[model samples]
Target chain A: MKHIESESNASLKQWKKLHSRKEREKTGTFLLEGPHLIEEAIHSGAKLQHVIVEENYQMKDEWLKERFSLWSVPAKLMKQLSETEKPQGILAVCEMMDQPEDLIKPKGRYLLIDGVQDPGNLGTIIRTADSAGLDGVFLGEGTADLYNGKTVRSTQGSLFHLPVVKADLLQIIGQCKEQDIPVLSTSLQEAVDMRRASEVEGFALIVGNEGAGVQETLQKESTMNVKIPIFGQAESLNVSVATGILLYELQRNRS
Target chain B: MKHIESESNASLKQWKKLHSRKEREKTGTFLLEGPHLIEEAIHSGAKLQHVIVEENYQMKDEWLKERFSLWSVPAKLMKQLSETEKPQGILAVCEMMDQPEDLIKPKGRYLLIDGVQDPGNLGTIIRTADSAGLDGVFLGEGTADLYNGKTVRSTQGSLFHLPVVKADLLQIIGQCKEQDIPVLSTSLQEAVDMRRASEVEGFALIVGNEGAGVQETLQKESTMNVKIPIFGQAESLNVSVATGILLYELQRNRS
Candidate 1:
């Protein structure tokens, strides 16, 4: 274990920069807080750079100590690195996950998001996608940063379970078409009843912004558009919840 | 129209008390912020006790002005009443919605929540239930206060559309049993696959705490236990998203 007491410690400065999307993207590294997420990352075989722990912290998990070195941080310094109201005493600095070559491959269920602005919503969508056994998620421009703290926390470690790659939705839809996979978009105008949607072997489901449905261009490009009927008066469902329903319905036919 | 300038005003003090659950319960009133929610409440025929706005704020909606008198407050006082980071210029203090007489009647889709601690999750569940045309939602003990700011906000005005009554789960489940309404609980312990679970016309779906599934007592009491299968590495779904999926699937059989 290495002790770091200074406020301006070099490594601390680098970790602080991980808070910014630009810094995270440029460096290809991010920070994760709490034991649950860290343990999940470990189980997923994520490449952890180092584990940072508050000074005097005891290693209850013997495997953790043997797997990675601990950089002992001052309690105050650890607080600075935390994103939650109550700072968990430990964090892991991890490299950006590499997407598998077959992430965009045909014959698998996938979630395609465009400009889903809320971090919590985006994260929940990713987690739901993982639970649905999605091959990967394609995130397009204007979407929340995959590394945003809220997004990471809301994902509940599913971030490590599946590939969430940023790409153009139109481009991804084109690829799906070429691969003989259907692309579905949610839209009020063009959408048919969700039940009427075909249960194909492979398909990509597109969910969009909280305030807006899928973009016009993307909706037009999809193989079909479906709408979850609002049987009552609420204008719409929460974006993440809507995605979950759509994903579950799509998978219901598979099994 | 009324002007409230002093922070010590009696009504303002009462409004402040609404921030607490005890006060909201005792007074039978709650605060609502933002134009969208306020407008929704107004449209839902929710009794508007008071509509407070910035002194210079103007009501362009003729129906709003004719239906309810406006109370103008200085910007600072309005800020004190606001909960969001960016508060809309208007806020409404409305009467607690009356849970309809036939809320638990035998023939409508329903949701029963047990110990769901997150206000946001509870709110989203209520919103989704409303969207699915659920008759009413029975919120049992240990669940987040429906009047909590986060809960109110997340409901997205669906709060006014449906009856969300606080009750004891066991008692409600007993009533559901008597009414011959099928009560289904989500469980990993003794659950059948959700896809195979029969969706009936009038069923009560019980969702529990984010960490703990339905209470053993409640689970054992349910007519059936169903689980959403995880086809990937993730262990569970976000509570609200799970609720959304359940509500949609259950409703799919209806309309």
Candidate 2:
């Protein structure tokens, strides 16, 4: 373990650059903050390159001291590296797992996200997918960066528990079809009531943008488009909440 | 209709002060920004005391000029009175609905919230309750203020469509018992699986703090304690998502 007291340090500069999405993508790694997330990363065998902590923060796990490159920085430096208003004094740099095209299997439950622009919403949806025991999550183009700080925080460490891949929706949809997995798309018009949608063994549920229900091309490609019934005056449900309800319904009625 | 260019003007000052919870509570009114919310406010028959817009904004609704006290302020002043990153150039001063004690009926679906601290989560829960056609939403102490901007935005104007009351959860539970309405309290321990829970005609579901499940005293007072089964590795669901799932289950199984 070493102490990093200066922001001008070369290593500190590189760590600070991880805050940018371009830098994260280039390095194939992302920074996640807080003690719980770091612990989760360690437990999940995520490739954590470095574990950084504020100088005053106590090291709870003695094993972490020797597990990876440990660096202690001043509170000012920690705050600069953190995205939240209240920094938890610890963060880790973990390699983005290499996702192969075969991450999705023939018999699996999956979530296909298209154009969810909010990082918080994307993270919550990922977390919900994990909570529903979905086999994987495929993020289409225009979705928020999965490695964004807010997305990491909102995920509550569930990102480590599931397979989340960034891929093209059309190609992924084609793959699901080839594998005989029914893809259910959520839509606001000309769709079967979600409650009455037939149950399937292997499925891919597609949820879309906040304002636009789902892209027309994607809706056309889906095996069926389903809509949750609004029993009251609310025009719509929040995207994350709606996804949760749909996932729960899918799981609840699985034959 | 009047035009005001100065932030120090009396009405503009009062509108700016509505940004704070103390001022909003004291005045029994709240400020809502954006065009959609203003339209929702008008359509819901909510008491709109004042409508303020940027000087450059075009009035699409001529009736708004005659319906309320319309004030036009310069962009700089409108920005000062707005909460969003980009002010939509229109906002309204709405009187808070006076919620009567008798809002809860003998046979009606309802949601009881306790200690949900995040304004966004609280608002989304309320919106979900509205989507589920709950008759009312009773907020217990420690919950976020319903009039908070984030909470209001999260509701997406569902706040205007339903009766939302600030009340004591224990007292509300007592009333449910007296009226023979089933009270379903969510709990993490020693609770029946919600999937197996019987359907009901009219029910009140209680969801609690983000960290803590429903309060013990309130849980003890309930007809039954129910738990959503966790099918995955997630420790728990986001409070709002969990509330949405529970409400959906309640409505889906309504006999």
Per residue, candidate 2 scores C-alpha lDDT tens digits across B96-168 of 9877667667888889998999999999998999898889999999999999999998999899889999998
For model 2, which pairs clash? Answer: none
Provide the TM-score of chain A alone for each candidate, in the order shown: 0.95, 0.96
Candidate achieving the largest TM-score: 2
Off by over 4 Å in 1: A65-67, B64-69
Candidate-wise lDDT, in order: 0.87, 0.88
Each prediction's TM-score versus the true structure: 0.96, 0.97
TM-score of chain A of 2: 0.96
lDDT of 1 by residue, B1-255 (tens): 799999999988888888999998898989999888888887778888888889887766654654666889998998888887777888888888887665677676789999999998999989999899888899889999999999999999999888899998898888888899999999987688877775577889999999987999999899999988888888899999988888878777666
Off by over 4 Å in 2: B253-255
Choose the strongest candidate by lDDT: 2
User: Who wins the DockQ comparison?
Assistant: 1
